[model samples]
Target: MTDSKDLDQVRSEIDTLDQQLQELINRRAGLAQEVADIKMAEAQQARADGAESAEVVFYRPEREAQVLARIMERNQGPLPAKNVAAIFREIMSACLALERPMQVAYLGPEGTFTQAAAIKHFGHAVLDVSQDTIAGVFNQVESGQCNYGVVPVENSTEGMVNHTLDNFMDSGLQICGEVELRIHHHLLAAAHTSAADIVKIYTHQQTLAQCRDWLEAHWPQVEKIAVSSNAMGARLAASEPGAAAIGGDMAATQYELQRLAENIEDNPDNTTRFLIIGSEEVLPSGNDKTSIIVASRNRPGALFALLEPFRQAGVSLTRLDTRPSRTEKWAYVFFIEFEGHLRDPNVAAIVAQLEEQSILLKPLGSYPKAVI
Candidate 1:
């Protein structure tokens, strides 16, 4: 219904709008740099005033969360709110990099889901360090080698990532944010390999489980071998003859493999939840969640006693999981996630009450819930 002349005029207007957008983005970046400078001055003043441990923090999780939320709230567009927020996420990421580039560590060989999650949470401007293990990711963040770490906590299909949960028990790192990534697995082979020639299939154990039904239905006779990671599987598939890998699009692209079958997971809505760990505690974002670990005395109804206060305070419990307390045989530690920031009056009162009921009540962190 549109004419060529009108289209040409609209295209010209769009180009002008893009130029204005670029100018505004650069101006925002300049303001972020100024904010960094002011923070540096405050740090210096604190040190001069005998506050020796003061350090300037350029990234404010709560502030960024608030900004993203406001952006979504103000969105009036043909584009969806999430799409608008994602655009602002990159803009904020670039602005933050102008001040100080964030270093993020994740469990990876480069193309793993954790890497994707890290990018999703921190945006593309961050410096991503690929650690061989989830514990390594935690160690890097704890040692201050990276500003943040991303680790998988649970998969919708596979439940908990025990290694990550166990590491949290030992580490003091705070949960700064969370990201949920929808997973789509593909059956991939090297470009030269054909479907009939594929005898061996490689993938991570979880990936193998996810695609179990699909593999049985199609490549029933194929030898299924579990590898360390999906990235490694794709790597092997790329190098070996008559080999295929079960992994996501990222790995297939990164390893230059050809997709034979896409979205082969048994579950259509497969998803994984990853947590962003950091050394600093996040202040209250308007909407936030708090995570904690509680070890109660070995007694019947101990958990009920521990949780009763939350119910009494009208606090909503989001998740609760129990793990064996390594220090004591047969004793258990409960990991709890609840809505509301720890600083909230109801949350604070509930935490006080929980401490009295449990042998150990460790407040992991209060952070903004996932914004995008």
Candidate 2:
């Protein structure tokens, strides 16, 4: 009887805390709406003054990054810092929706890792639209059909995603943010199917390669098939009786499949980096990365010439890759990423120096480094 009374008292305290939390969240939402209103009014006044680009932009990646960083910094939690920040993210996402609804596009048949990255970056309140291809994702954002798009840029095991890089060549979209998702491949099948019943396994070609050794060791006799995406493979697994698919958690849930095995990728540290493309440029978040494309004259030591400026300016280079140039058959363009915003003095000086040496230089916009 005493234990039951103690349980009831704890439950009562929890309910009281929940009520207080709900009130605070609503109060925070009211403040967000007020901020939106003020911005909208300011934008309207600017339009009256003949400003062409006085549109109210509600989503600020840098601001969100800073907020999340602060939240993590100040946490003294029984709950993990990341967990607390995530709860705040959904709160902010919901409050932002009260201000203005957001739409985001990602490459998908609906259950791809890119989609998961989108949710991670933007939160679940935003409407997520699925595009058939990476280019389609860019087009969606470029055309203003969606406010932003998420697309995979690189995989740890496979290197760069060339299709995503190619899309950046012609598109005017800016890189607003980035996300790094840990890739975990799961063996999934329909509820009625089991390991002994499986005849074929399906997954994306890249995924199949990631889990190659594990697959060879466990299911040696099973036929493996490559599909366009893991989500597609999940679809097949859901429909076919004797088929299983290697995919991530989202795919398993989306297709209502059971996980036969978890984290089957050969490389345990498998991670994929995704870029968020948008129409607006993101301001500096203290911690940021800038991406650019440069073309140099075909000559000896051209690579050194391009890289010398960054070294001279003391800017750290994070990534450097070469892509086939669309303008010249034999020439290639350099895709460079570094650790500073374009607005920084050293970064700006480096860009000026590169402009003097390179035939073509294009700034792809600086963005906040991934926080979560």
Candidate 3:
């Protein structure tokens, strides 16, 4: 205790330990990002198979609650809860920023999950505009109302968002960027109480659909009510003691409600992917993905001809979605998302061929692939 040099040595060792810890944490984060990138690629491939149809229009509030709770449970070390959330929040922000200062539109009434995802991708600093419906969001981007729009494309537990797909077919919008948000649902009751006394469950129609099987098994007799959106449902429940709503945790915290049940989905691997819409191209950063829409004549060989070029050009197609063309009764357009960028010579060549073969071909632009 009386030796100054000894104290100095101890401090120096502590400093070196701190340095090591920082390096170790950074390495771990880098690896996590890499894995996330791989998952995106796998999902794009999955979407191509029409298996994305499984979640075409589904939602599960309880399972989403579980994931966030687990994320909170696993958190440890010197980082505080807010700080850790902030880091991940920013990690997503940077991924969307590989192309910079993007303007994003979303379906919103404030506090909606789409709004949350929009911020997660573009950050609070981004220019955000919200419309009432998914189609409205696309229309805004299509009419140049916004630089890009953020919309839900698919959910792991539920299925594809047909409204979003339908809009993609009709509008000039194209998916320039993609982000996946692992949904965590919670039962937010207005007052602090147990689950037994709850009389009803409230949430968006989609949320109710996602958790349908789980809810039927547990609260079979409980009245399931649909609201405008999950966030709005939570807001209403936060003021009614016997009422409960399923929504993101932010809604619970905002309304000062109690979280009753967490992660209540039938599927544990539930996640939702979002698309970034823009009229022009995204400047690439080495890694990239491109999405396009091809409108074919409503004939027997139409779709086959549209896809043949990609197979011949050796272009790996990641997703192929067909939506009814609002233009006519039997008209339809094929939406395709694929690996590689427009800047790539091979990608450009394939586009040229597809254009010659199809009635209309729209390139949604290429954006940097998520570094994760």
Q: Which regions of candidate 2 are displaced past 4 Å? A: 1-5
lDDT (10s digit) by residue, model 2, range 200-288: 99999989889999999999999999998999999999999899999999999999999999999999999999999998879999999
Q: Write the per-residue lDDT of candidate 1 for residues 1-372, one digit (tens) a residue.
A: 554568778899999999999999999988999999999999999999999698889999999899999999999998999999999888989889998998999999978998988888788999999999999999999999999999999899998898988998889999999999999999999999999999899999999888889999998988999998999999999999999999887898899989899999999999999999999989999999999999999988888999899889888898899999989999999999999998999999998888887888888999999988
Report clashes for each candidate as comma-separated counts. Answer: 0, 0, 21
**Ordered list by lDDT, greatest first:** 2, 1, 3
lDDT of 3 at 316: 82
Q: Using Cα atoms with residue i matched to residue i, what is each candidate's TM-score against the true structure? A: 0.97, 0.97, 0.70
Off by over 4 Å in 1: 1-5
* Location of the lowest summed lDDT over 10 successive residues in candidate 2: 1-10
Q: How many Å off is the CA of 304 in candidate 1? A: 1.4
Worst 10 residues of 1 by lDDT: 1-10
- In order, candidate lDDTs are 0.92, 0.94, 0.71
Give me the overall lDDT of model 1: 0.92
